[model samples]
Target chain A: MSAFDWLPELLERFKADYVLIHEDAAVTTVGRARVLELDAEDWGRAAGVAAKFNLRWAGGWADQLTDQLGGDKLQINACLLHQGDVLLLRTRVPVTTPVLPSHTLHYPGADRMERHTQDMYGVVFSDHPDPRRWARHHAWGENEYPLRAEFPRMGTRGDMPARTDDNYRFLQAQGAGLYEIPVGPVHAGIIEPGHFRFTAVGEQVLNLEQRLGYVHKGIEKIAVGRDAVGAARLAGRVSGDSTVAFTWAACMAMEQAAGVEVPLRANYLRAIMAERERVANHLGDIGAICNDVGFAFAFYQFSRLREDWQRLSREVFGHRLLMDCVVPGGVARDIDAAAVAQLRAAFAPMKREMRELMPILYDNPSLEDRLITTGFLSESLARLLGATGYVGKASNCDLDARRDLAYSPYDRFKIKVHVFQDGDVLARMRVRADEILISLDLIDELLAGLPNGDVRAEWPMPAAGSEGLGIVEGWRGETLVYVRFAEDGKIARLFARDPSWFTWPALEQLIHGNIVPDFPVCNKSVNGSYSGHDL
Target chain B: MLRLFNKIRKIGVVTEPVMPGRDPAFEEIGEQLHARVGELFSGSLAIREVDAGSCNGCELEVHALNNPYYGIERFGVHFVASPRHADMLLVTGPVSKHMEAALKRTYDATPDPKLVLAMGDCGADGGEFGCSYASCGGVSKVIPVDGVVRGCPPTPLELMKAILALIEKRQGG
Candidate 1:
C-alpha cells in the first residue's frame, strides 16, 4: 500500500474510537487529505471526547469525526479527511431525526454549516441557538425535513397538517408610529413566493423581515436511494438557474467518496458548463437588478442579451439551460469541436455589446440614484453572515470556493474573483455585471486549451460505509453538499446547503434602515435561491 | 438621454408583426412593446407560476428571467408588483394550497387581456409536487390558462419562447 495506508495504524495509535468499517487504498488529495475510510457512526461523540481530552490530531485531522449517522449505507454516506494529521468527519444521512451534535464547538465553519444541515435535512442541531426555521419558514410546515430517508417519494404522500395560527412573534419595533407593511408571500411580478414584513415609520424602514420557503420540493429526501447517476439528476434541479454548479459539486463529492477518478476532459467540460452558467446568471441578474429600479432600458438590453445567451446554450449544449448535462463521474454530454468554435464566435459580439451597455448603466443618473447607497452591509456583517457568491464579494469577503477553496480544474485555472467594498445594491449589481465579463473570458480560455480525452469515467462502486463532502460556488453563493452512505452504498443522509441560508437571514438584516420601496431592489440584488436552501 | 439612445442602439432593432388578443388595449400595449422591447416580449401576458410545494426550482429561473437575463421590460411588459399591473399571469410550480390565495389575488388583480402562462411541469400539471392534498393541481383550476412551458422548471429560453408565442397569439397572427 502507499504511504497513506498508515492511516489505520495511526488511528489505533491515537486511541481514537474508530471501528474501521472499511478502508480503501485509493488516493484523492488536493492539499488536505487523501484516504477513504469508514468507522462506527457514533465516531463523532468519541471524537468530541477526544477533542475534550486534548488528543491533538495530526494536521487538524481530529475534527472530521461524525457523531451521529442516519440513512442506509446503500444511500447513507460518511467521509473522513486526514492530511498529515487533520481529520474532518462528514456524513450524508437522510432527514430523519437528523440529530447531529453542534460541530461549531469543534469547527467554527460548522456554525452556519450545522444550520444548513438542519435546514435541508430537518436535522436537529443539539443546541443551535438560532433555530428559527432556516429554509422552511414560509414554504413547508414544521414536519417537513427534506433529507430524511423515510420521506415519501411520489411527492409527500402523507396528509398535510392543517394550517395552524403561526405563533411567531414579530420582533416588536420600539419606535412610535412604526407600522408593518407586509409585501409578499405573493407579490406584483412573476416572482417566487416569499413574505416580506417591513416595519416602517412612514417611508423609512425601521426593520424588514423576510419569510421564504414557499417552494420547498423535498429534493434531498428524493435523492436518497438514488444511485450516483440519479443523484446528479436531482442535483441539477436543486436550483434550476445554476444547474451545472450544483451537479458538478455533487459529482465531485460523490466521485471523491467513491474514490473514482474523472477524465481530464470531463473536468474541463464541467468547468466550461459552470462558466457558462455563471455568465448566463450574471447577465440576467445585472439586467434584473437594473429593472428593479425602474431602469427599463437596462432591463430590456440585459434581458435581450440573456435570451440570446440561453439560446446559444440550447444550441451548443442541448437543453436550453444546459440542465442534466453534468452527470456523476463525468458530464452527461460533451461539447463538440464545432460547438466550441461557435461559442468562441458568440462571445466576441456579446462582449462588445456588454462593453457598450455597461457605461450607459454606470452613467445613468436615475438608476444610480436608486442603487447608490441602498441596502448597505458592512464588511463585518457580511463575514458574520457568511454571504457567498457576488453578495459576499461586494461586501469585501474575499472567499470563492472556486478560488480560495480551489477544487478540480478550478484549482488548475487561476479564477479571477471580482471584489468590492461598497456592500450596497449598486455594488452587488456591479459585481455581478463584471463577473459576467470575467466568466465569458474564462470560457474562451477553457475552449482554447480544451482537454482531448474521454468525457465520462466509470465510477467505481463505493465500499460500504464511505462518505464525502462537496462545496460549489453557485450563482447566488456557496452551495455545500455532504453525502453519507450506508454499508451498501445507499444514500443514508444527503445535506445540500444552499447559499440562501446565510443570504436569506441577511435579507432581513439588510432592509434595516432602507425604505419599504427599496426592498425589492435590494432583495433582487442578492437573489438567494430558496429551493436550493429548502432541499 | 444619450445613455438611453446608446442602450437602444446596442439592443439592435426588430421589426416583427404584433398579434391581437381578446382585448384591444392589451393588443396595443403589445404593439408598443414590439416597437420598444422587441418581439421576444411583445404582447399582453398573464403569468401563473405554481409552487408545487417546490424546492423552488422554477422560481429561481423565473426570478432570473425577470431580473436581467430576460428582463421582461423594454417591451412595455413589467412584472407588475401586483397582479393588477399584469395582463398575463405566469405560474411556476405544482400549485400548493399555501400559495392558492396569493396566486388567486395575483391573477384576480389583473384586468382583462390577461393570458395565463403555466411556466413549469408543476404548473402544467402537478409535476413532482402533484397528488398531495397540500397541492391545488394546475394553474387552470385556479385561473384561466393561455399557454404552457413545460420542464421541471422550463429554462429561461423556453420561458421566452412561450411568452413570445403568447404575444403572437394575442395579435391573432
Candidate 2:
C-alpha cells in the first residue's frame, strides 16, 4: 500500500466528517465519509468534508479549485500539507454569498493567494486579516468580482474611479525626513505595469509595497466556458514569459483527468521547449542584472546574444516564444532534421563565447560591488514566502519540480540544482547563469537521445466524478493546475496557480533596507510575471 | 577623471552612442557600437530579457529561440537586464493602456544607438489584444521601433533573425 493508505486514520485524528470513502480504485473521501464508489455527489460531499478537516466549502464544484475556500475552513486551508500528494477542491453555492474560511491563518503562504481569490471570485472570507482587495486594485469597483459567472464579458464601466484615490490604501509614511516615492504604473524600461510605493529615508528604503493588477486580463473568467483546446490556448497566454510551463501544467491536469497518455516523444519535446524558455530568460536576466549595476558591456553582449537565440527559435519552434506549441494529448508541430542540425551547429560557439564573457563579469570589481549585497533575502524568508525559480534556488529553497515531483523523463535524468546561502541579487544572478549552462547541457542530452513515437494519444472521456492534479516547476517556480471534467468530457472547472503569486509578495520583503535606486535592480533580479498572477 | 573612470570601468555590453535617439559628445560612442555590432554577426550571444507591456505572445519565442538544441545564444546574441547595459530591446506585445508611459520610459532609459526591435504580431500591429480596451496596440505607438519581428509572437528563429538584422543595420552593413 502507498503511504497515503493511512489517510483515513489521519482524518479520524482530526475528527473530519467521514462522509464517504471510495475503497475500490484508490481510496477517496467525500464530505465526512470514506467509501468505495464512483459517484458525483460523493465527490461534491468530499469537498464539503474538507471543511471538517478545516477546509471551507464555499465555491461551486468544478474540475479544480484555484479560488478561495471561505468561512471556517479558511484557517484549515492555510495549514494543511500532504507529502507526495495534491489537493483539488471546488465549491458551488446556490446563494450569491458564497463563504469560504481564510486559510492564511493556518498556512502563511496562502495569505496573498486567498485575498486574490476573494477579489476575483467574489468569495467572502470572514475575519481574514488584511482583507484589502488584492487583484481588483481599482480595476473593478466594490462587489465587482471579475471572475464571477455573472460578470458581463463586453461591458464598459465608464470612468471607473481611480484605485489609489479611493480603494488601494497605502500605509502612511510619517515623521520628518521620511517621504514616499511613487514610481510607475509607468516605468522607464521595457517591463510590465506594477506600481511601487517606496517609503524611504534619503537613499535607504524603509518599506516598499507593490500594487499590481494594472494589466489584469480576466483570463480565469474567460476559461469558465472554454473547451479543453480553448483553455489550453488561454493557459499558454496566462503569462507570456512562461507559456511553456503554464500550458504544460494545464495539459498535464487535463490529460490526467481524462486518463489520456501523452506520447513519449511529446513529453521529450515539451522538456526541450521548457529548457529553451529557461535559457532565454536566464540569459536576459543575467545581462539585465549586470547592466543595472552600471556594467554596460555584459548587458549589451547578453542582449545581442538573447536576440540571436530567439531568431533561431523561429526556425525550430515556428514561433519564437513557442506559444500554443503545447496542446492536449501532444504538441501542435514537430521539429524537423534541419532544425536539429542548426541547433547542434549553433550551441558550440555560443557556449564558448559565454565562457569567455563569464570571467570578465566575475573579475570586474564594480560588477561584484553592485550585485553582491544588494537585495538580500534570507533563506528562511525565501522558504516561508515560497519564492520559486532562480530567486528561491539562490536563497536555498532546494526544490525543483522536475526532481521534487518526478513525472516522466525528468525522473530518468539527473537535474542539477544550483543553490546559494547568500540569497541576494548576486546569488540569484549566479544561479540563473549556472542554470542556463545546465539547461543547455540537458537539451543536448534530450536531442541526442531523441525518442521515436507518436506525439499525441487518444483522450479518453473522464468519468463524471473523476478529477486530477498537475504541478510543474515552471521557469519561474512550481506551477499548479487542476482539471475536472463533466460527464461528457467537457471542462467542469479549471484553476491555475502561477509562482509569481508567491514571489511578488517576497519582493516587498527583500526590498527592506535596500536603497531606493536599487529597487529596480532587485526587482529585475526576481523578475516575477504580473500576467501570470493576474490571470 | 573619476567620472570618466567610472564610465570606463563598467563591464556589460557597451555599444556606440550611449543613448539612442540622442546625440553624444564623443565620436567614440558611434565607433564602439559599430565594432560591437560587427562582433555579434561573427559570434553568438545570450540575452537576459524583461517584459514591459506585451500580450506575452512575444515572450514565447523570445524564450523558444534558445531551447536546447536550438541554442540561439550560440549565434552571438543575448538578452540583458539593465537599460544602461543592453544592445537592443526585443519588445513584444502592444503597449497597453497602463504600460504606455513605462514603455517610453524603458526606451528612453536604454543606452544610445540601441536597436529597438518590436517582436511578434502584436509588437508590430497590436495582434488580437491591440484593439482591445486594455491595450495601446503596437509598442511603436510609444517608442521608436528599429526592427519589426513579425508573426503572432514570431517563431524563435524569426525573432533571432530580426535581432541579427538589427546588429547588421547598426554596423552599417
Candidate 3:
C-alpha cells in the first residue's frame, strides 16, 4: 500500500468527506497531490488529526467564489504533508458570513497564512490567535475584500491612499529591562521591505514579530481575468529569485489542466534553468551571510561568482534573472549546441571556486563559532512550522520535492537530497553549499541526457472551470502555485505560495534567545523572501 | 587563511577599468559621471535605495554595483544605510500602497538638490502590476522622479548609465 493510505481512513474516521482530486491520472505529472473537499467542521478537526498523525502543515489559502460557480462561497484549502505525500483539505463557507475553525492551536505556522487569507478573502477563523490586518493594511476599505469577485482588480479608489498604519500591535515582553527594537519596511540593505519588531531583554531577543505586506502590489488580485500565459508571466514575478520555479509551477498547473504532454526536452531545459537559479541564489546568499557576519572577503568572491553566473544566464536564457523563460506549454528559450558548450564552460570555474571556498569556511574558527549554535530550529519545531528546503533540510526534515515528489527530468536521475541535523546557521549554509554542487551535477546530467525534439508543445486551453496545483522545490524551498481556469482561458483564481510563507514564521521562532546582533546572520541564514511573502 | 590569501591574489584586479555602457550617449554619460560627481556632490555620490514594491530583480542588479566587476565604489558611489547621508536615491518598483509613506519619508529625509532616479520598468510606470488599489503606478506618483531607467529590471550597466544620465541632466541643465 502507498504510505498515505492511512491518511484518508484517519480523516474519514473524523467524518470528513473526500473527493479524489487528480481524476486524470493518465495525464498526471503535476497532479500527484491528494485534494479533498470536506465539511467546514471536519476540515478544522483534520488539523487535530494531522497533529496526532504527525503530518506537517504545508500551507493554507482562502478563495472567493462567485454565485455562478454553484453559489457565492468562500473556499478554504489547507495542505498537510506526511513523508512525500501532499494532502490538501478543502471546505466552503457561505460568502455572506464566512467562518471556519482555526488550525493555529495545532499548527503554529498557520498564524500568518490564515490572517493573509482572511485579509484577502474576508473570511474569519473562529479561534484565530492573532487577527490583526496583514495584507489588508489600509489598501481597501475596512469591509472591502479585494479577492472577492465583486471587487475590481483596480479598486474603487482612483488614487493611492496615505499611510497612517504605524500602530501594528506587536506582543511586547513584560518585566524590567525589556525593550522593543523596530526594524524596517524599508531595510538598510538592498533588500525587499518588511518590518521586524524585536522584543529583547538586553542583548538577547525575547521574540520577533514580522510586519510584512509592504510589497503587496495586488499581484493575486491583478492575476484574475488574465490568460494562462499572462498569469504565468505574473507568476514569474511572484518571487524574482525563484522565477524559474514559480513559472514552471504555473505552467505545470496550466499544462495539467490542459492535459498537455510537455516535450521531454523542454523538461530538461526547465531543470537546468531551475538548477542554475538555485546555484546562483546560493552563491549570492553564501556571500551575503558572510557579509552580515563581518566577513567581507567571501562576500565579494561569492557576489562575483553570482554576477558571472547571471551573465551566463542572460547569454543563454535572455534574462539575467531568467524571467519569462518558462512559458505556458513549454519554455520560451531553447539552447543551441554552442550555448550548451558556453554553459558547461561557465559552470566549471564556479563549481571549482565553490569547492575551494567551502573548506575555508569550515576551517574558519570565527565563522564556525558564530554559526555553529546560533538561530537553532529543532527538527520538531521545523516540522511544526512546516519548514521546507534548506531551512527544513538544515533542521533534519530531510525531504526534497525533487526527490520526494519525483517530477520529470528529476525522475530520470537519483537526486541527492542533503540533510543536516545541526539546524544552525552553519547547517543552513552547508545545505546551500552542498545543494549547489548537487544542482551543478544535475545540470550536467540534464545537458547530457537532453532529448532531441521540439521544445514547445502547443495545446488547446482546457475548458472553463478547470483547476490544477503546481509545487516545485525552489532555491529557498517549496513553491506552490494553484490555478483555476475561467471561460476564454482567463484565470478565475491564482495563488503562488512563496517558500517564504512557511519559513518566514520559522525565522520568528528561531530568533528567540538569539542576540540582537546575531539576528542578521540568523536572518541571512533563512533569507526568507519579502517580495514573495508579501505578494 | 593562507589558502584564502592565495586565492585572493590569484583573483586580483577583477574589476573592469571602465564601466561599459549600452550606447554612445550612455558611454558619454558614464565618462562624465565621476567629474560630474566632483562638481555636484564633491567627489563622492551616495545613493539610498528604497524598495517601494518589487520582485527584487532590480535590487539584485543594483547590489551587483558593489561586486568586484562593477566596483561602483571605485567611482566613489556609495550605497548609504540612511537617506540623510545620501546625495541621490536609486529607488526600485512601483509605489505599493503600504510603502507610499515610507518612500515619501525617505525622499523628504534626503537633503534638497537630491536626485531621485527610478530604476526598472515597475519604478518607471508600474510595468506589470499597474495602477491598482495596491500599486500607485510609478515612483513619481509618490515622489518627484529625476529620471527613469526602464527595463523589466535594467542591467547593472543600464542602471549605472541611467544614474549618470540623470546627474548630467539635472546639473547640466
Number of the predicted model whose lDDT against the real structure is largest: 3
DockQ of 1: 0.29
* CA lDDT scores, all candidates in order: 0.65, 0.65, 0.85
Q: Against the true two-chain complex, what DockQ does each candidate achieve?
A: 0.29, 0.14, 0.79
True contacts kept of each: 0.35, 0.19, 0.83
Pick the winner on DockQ between candidates 1 and 2.
1
Best candidate (score: DockQ): 3
Model 3: what is its DockQ? 0.79
| lDDT tens per residue, model 2, A366-477 | 8788888889998877766667678889898777878756676687789998899898898988888888788888888888887888887776666664555567778887
Ranking by TM-score: 3, 1, 2
TM match of model 2 to true structure:
0.74
Which candidate, 1 or 2, has the higher TM-score? 1
Candidate 1: which stretches are off by over 4 Å? A1-127, A133-165, A487-489, B1-4, B15-80, B83-89, B96-117, B125-149, B155-173
- Sliding window of 10 residues with minimal summed lDDT for model 3 chain B: B18-27
For each prediction, how big is the interface RMSD?
5.1, 8.1, 1.1
lDDT-wise, the better of 1 and 2 is 2
